[model samples]
Target: MKQETFGRFEVGSCSRSTELQEERELIQNPNLNPGSSSLSSVVNECKKRRPINFCQEEEEERSLKKRRIVQDTTIPEWLVNVMMREEINGYDPKLILAKKLYKSDIDKVQSRLSLPSNQVVTSDFLSEEESRVIYEQSVLKNRTEGLSVVLVDPLLKKHVVDLRKWKMGGNWNYVFVDGWNQVVSTNTFKVGNVYHVWSFRSGGGKLCFALVPPRNSSDSGHGGSSSGLSSR
Candidate 1:
């Protein structure tokens, strides 16, 4: 009998016979394949450790873009002023002023103001009619003291004319009331008309004046109609 050494395993004459018999048995049994179990386990571990796919990454990016767009909307300042003026006057001064200043040419006027096209058409701040009113009120206020008066309406077209202009037969008038009140009376020169009067009293003091149209008649009543009162 011969002895042999094969890698880590040694076969002596007595053990060689037993080893040979064992090797022959293993060859006949197909189930005894070497490393097959370990190879199968390695393959399953690799499958479980695979990387993520591409579609999920794109979905996250799209969601972020949508959120950013929603956060960027805002309103302008000029429109805010127009809204406030309208609230104070109870009329759309912006619209009336726009008409007077632009003479019904809204597009030309908007271009001059350098307003955006979308703003001119869709802004809630001021319409063409409201802009016209504000413009007239501003012009009148600048021209003369007590000559131009703004009514509660922001719209200048619906303005209550000063009584002084009418008293001078110039379509309006200026009359002085107590320091706390003023009257726009059409009754003085025109005979029969309603009085549009405004009165104010505050911590400062009482200040009042009257607006009357100019009169052509010789009936010059002086006591009730006097010079404009100084605001104290």
Candidate 2:
């Protein structure tokens, strides 16, 4: 009876040991029971690590998208076109285009247009000294022709006379006025027929034209007129 009881106890102990070994083997090989509690714990840890890595990737993607949006929003297509056109035209078109685009002001547009045109004129008879002589001649002729004369010397930086106090050049003819109010007195000095006059202050400068009437013409009261000086 004692031997049978000991044998039974030993057998039971062996069975329990076998069951524990089987469970340890199953835990060691993840592929054996991938859904086991121990496997489930590993999967949970992997899942946790995946989300952290995914969140970092998502943040990087969002930052890239934000930078792209900012770059696209800052530059407009029209402004780019204006910049390219300016390169071709040799002037800053952006500022000019802006003034026109925003305001329908004709004066502003005309002021910008007054910049030199592309026309070229050549005169072989007018050397630098001869040119001065011709300018003086033109001024005297202008005075006789009832036009006003004003001489402008860029080098002197002084007006021969105060421009404002002088009367507007005669109504019938174009005027020749210098930076100083000095009217050309002789027929020997003449500037070009088209002259550009700029004032130090706001109201006085303009472009003037000297008109020589054709013979046998009846338009005595109506002489040549200057266009750019008049306000828009």
lDDT winner: 1
Q: Which stretches of candidate 1 lie over 4 Å from their true place?
A: 1-52, 74-232
In the range 176-232, model 1's lDDT, one tens digit per residue, is: 212212211211222232122222212232221122212222232321212221221
With candidate 1 superimposed using the best TM-score fit, by how many Å does residue 97's alpha carbon deviate from the native?
28
TM-score of each: 0.16, 0.20
What is candidate 1's TM-score against the reference? 0.16
Q: Tell me the lDDT of model 1 at 150.
A: 32
Which stretch of 10 consecutive residues in model 2 shows the poorest summed lDDT?
93-102
lDDT of 2 by residue, 1-232 (tens): 1112222132112234344555675777746776677656655544433312345788999999899656433433222222233212212111101111111111222211111112112123123553344345444443222222222221211123211112223322112233212222211123222222221111132212122222232332222221111111
